[model samples]
Target: MTPFLTGLGASLGLIVAIGAQNAFVLRQGIKREGVLPVVLVCLASDAILIFAGVAGIGALIQSAPALLVVIRWVGAAFLVTYAAFAAKRALRPGILEAATAPRGMTAWTAVLTAAGITWLNPHVYLDTLVLLGSLANAQGSPGKWLFGIGAATGSALWFPLIGFGARGLRGFFARPASWRILDGCVAVLMLGLAVVLAAEA
Candidate 1:
């Protein structure tokens, strides 16, 4: 039980950070584009990564800096591309209103984009695979599994809250100004992440 609480706290502490993943999720939720599948992919991927970390795959991943380097370049490219789209949208705020906007982004596209954001980022490995894995193992044998479960539970809870909860702001999002603001923030965030990744790479 103690380990469970620790896992929940630790996982939430990490997961709640503002990042490309969370930003993408919020945008999807606001757009009403494949929200369920997007949320599912995010949570499921987190579950897999967290379990892999707990199962000791973290060591294997850590041993390969080359692999992380490859991921860094790919992730930076993806972020830069997405940031361009966000910036364009911010410039042309007319398409911001989903109710009047043309159909866009298929379910597969949303899922793939969400997956790319989750899997391509090297930081996901550092946080979920390495850091969370270390914390789970620190709980010793019995508590480790419990801790992993608790951490997975945290992801399951948090993604939904952020994903669905953003819908409550749909009224505000209906305003073009709101969309511009959101897209501008997303652009800055994505570009910033891309620059950071490229620098590290």
Candidate 2:
């Protein structure tokens, strides 16, 4: 139980960061664009990554320097691209205030986008799965399950709070300026994360 708590704390430490997926999740929730599906995808993706981590794949993944490099470059590319898109949206006349308008995407699209964003981000695996897995391995035995559970729980805990919190702010942030602010923040965040990731990788 002590080890489990340690693992849980570690998981929360890794997750409680500013990142693209969280940003997107928050935006979707605020905009009410298939919030449930977005949150579910975020949770499911976290579960898969955490499971992989607990299974001791992190060490092997670490050993594969080439793969990590590829992921770093790919992630950077995606981040830059996403940042550009977010910046573009920020400039658009109605992107932000569109929340009161009809949703531009279907439910499936929302699900896929959320899942893909979570899955594609290199930091997600590096922080949650690999780091959490290695920590659990140190504890051994049933501790692995606990660590995975902890990480999964972190995601489960975070996504709902973010999603719901966004919804709660919808009424106040329903202005066009709000969308501009959100998207601008998204762009800055993605670019910053990408720079940090590439520097570390």
Question: Scored by CA lDDT, what does every candidate get?
Answer: 0.90, 0.80
List, residue by residue over 17-136, the lDDT tens digit for candidate 1. 999999999888887888899999999999999989999999899999999999999999999999998888888745555423645688899999999999999999999999999999
TM-score of 1: 0.95
Off by over 4 Å in 1: 93-102
Model 2, span 48-73: residue lDDT tens: 87888888778888888888777877
| Poorest 10 consecutive residues by lDDT, candidate 1 | 93-102
List of clashing residue pairs for candidate 1:
none
User: Which candidate leads the pack in lDDT?
Assistant: 1
Count of clashing pairs, candidate 2: 1
Q: Estimate each model's TM-score.
A: 0.95, 0.90
* Per-structure clash totals for the candidates: 0, 1
- Specify the highest-TM-score model's number: 1
Instruction: Please identify model 2 stretches exceeding 4 Å from their true place.
Output: 94-100
